[model samples]
Target: MKELQDKISKKLGFGCMRLPVRGEEMEQIDDELFCKMIDTFLAQGFNYFDTAYPYHKECSEAAIKRCLVERYDREQFLLADKMPIWLVKEPSDLNKVFETQLKRCGVTYFDAYLLHAMNKDRIRDAEEKGAFAFFQQMKQEGKIRHFGFSFHDKADVLDQILTNHPEFEFVQLQINYYDWDSEAVEAGKCYETAVKHKIPVIVMEPVKGGTLANLAEEPASFLKELHADVSLASYAVRYAASLENVIVVLSGMSDLEQMEDNISYMREFCPLSEKEKNAIAKAVEELKRFPTIACTKCRYCVDGCPKQILIPELFESYNMTAQFGESPATTRLYRKAIKDRGTAADCIRCGKCEAQCPQHLEIRKLLEQVSEMFG
Candidate 1:
């Protein structure tokens, strides 16, 4: 296995955002499955777990406590948690979140604690809401070993944060071959800025929310033709980890099979060899052939919208409609778009979302089209 640090070995960090569940609700956390996954993970010599305040919507930290922390000694693994500032309104709530996170995890301290989901709006809100001071206070109190944030914003905001908070130990970013130069995501520029800031990187979404897994037929066949044992996903994770200054590559393992596959490959980590690297290098071009709106899944526009429309899924459905021309798949997704939430038709063009969107998408216009198509 590749040693990230002598202090704590890193193979692939376990991201608990989309843990496997039974039916619809996440009340039951698949303990037997998750514990088996963790046991297999540790047996293979991998030990980094990343959980957030609202991962799986208030279930991640507690799941880790049961599936991992409670079962293993503190010294045996490294735990990473985040202070979810987006969930907060008042400044006093910062300490409350931090304290409650510690309590829920049943851990005295965190190896790495980050400000989660830090886009431009969230970062501004954090500073104005006294999160920085509270973060510093936690560091001084010995509650946090290292302080950082997971970001989803433009390069400038990243630069500003790194310049402003040089003391932060690392930055977690959504890095993958597909999003490297994407206008919607720009993973390359993000990674470069982090490198320029001399900040170590922890990569998330290397497989792009399982988007890479369900490739179109041609690419799927191409990948299948390449390797019999490895999956289409292994190439993606290998590509992300091949970058410089990347200390951790996190895959949100949803089940035992996924956990095993990721662990097996990451255990004896090797940089993608010349040919495999070249093949993965062509992923962006291959991905461009697919009909997809350049949505990065950042959800910045949805955050501040008065209408609360799910903009990302709108584009995703549109892309699906455009590509596959499949009525059932696209329409089912479209109907589900507003089944429990707002739709494009409700957009009043308050422009709150436009201001926060790092991609500079003409969200007002997109909403108009979405309303026309799906309303």
Candidate 2:
């Protein structure tokens, strides 16, 4: 009951992962646009902002420092910067990363600090590097107000981490209506596990990185029937936040329109009506009609792809191609991204990628579809 009642007002955490990019490079966050977006976010009373050392183009933390810390008062907004264990190679590297984040954010202290993107491997690495002790030290030093982790792993891994470290104040998970029953993510299962352990959940990508918002005909039409004014994006974020123990739901608001629409939902937050819930469930069921992989470009497949083509990216193009019909311009961009990577022609029919795939996807077949669509 305490967890439910302890709703942080405007718990709309601004995710700095996918900020508005300049052309193909995510490194270049459009300063004018992003600053405007930030200004709008702060003015509206939403406080939490999330960024990490390598969130955007491997230079996102610095962008946050420039755009946020220097711009907003320290007490007005809460900032959460995560320690990137995956990027650390040594035990001492942990301190280096932690300090780097502090320098990058240009803040003496962090409102919330998390062990970023804890998978099984990252968890193991953190254990070896005395990660928990480091957070304990930071807490004593007053550098961090709260300590936690953002996770993307199986429920067993989540359980292991939570049980092993009950001191963590919260857990961040990717939760959304589309990912509820998704085998590739199992967000619902992860959410339930957090509840059993009585941990507050910070939801990231509640709208599937805008994938749910820019829906196809079936979902768009179906949701339009439910509430003409309510965007499909609203249903996704609301569904995630409505879950038990959710402390905040983070949205990667890249533009003014997205920021306004999302904040609107936060202010007049409404729990999903039963009819609304059914509409969402039905909408998700309809979304599976599109043949897109769950490849979130988490960089899991990058190393395994023998052809070197960015597989997830090609899928993004594939979805767009099907959505907008054949336009030479669309295929041209896809071609440029894959030109050096050898189009889909260089897929060696090797099963190494398939072995590592959590989706158990038929990668070779996907390449053919990709080639036919864009080549």
**TM-scores of the models, in the order given:** 0.86, 0.90
lDDT of each: 0.80, 0.80
- lDDT by residue for model 1 over 178-274, one digit each (tens)? 8888776778999999989887899998888777866666666656667866888888888888886898899998888887778778888888878
List, residue by residue over 1-375, the lDDT tens digit for candidate 2. 242224345667898888887886777788778888888888887778888876775677888788888888887778888987867787788888888889888898887889987888788899898888888998899898888888878888899999888888888998888889988788889999999999888999888767788787877887889889978889888998787578789998878888889988887677788988888888888878767755554445556676787777777777777766668866776877686775676788877766555444677798798888765
True-vs-predicted CA distance for residue 281, candidate 1, Å: 3.2
In model 1, the runs with Cα more than 4 Å from the true position are: 1-5, 26-28, 294-317, 327-375
Clashes of 2: 0
Model 2 misplacement above 4 A: 1-8, 297-308, 322-333, 339-341, 347-365
Top-TM-score candidate index: 2
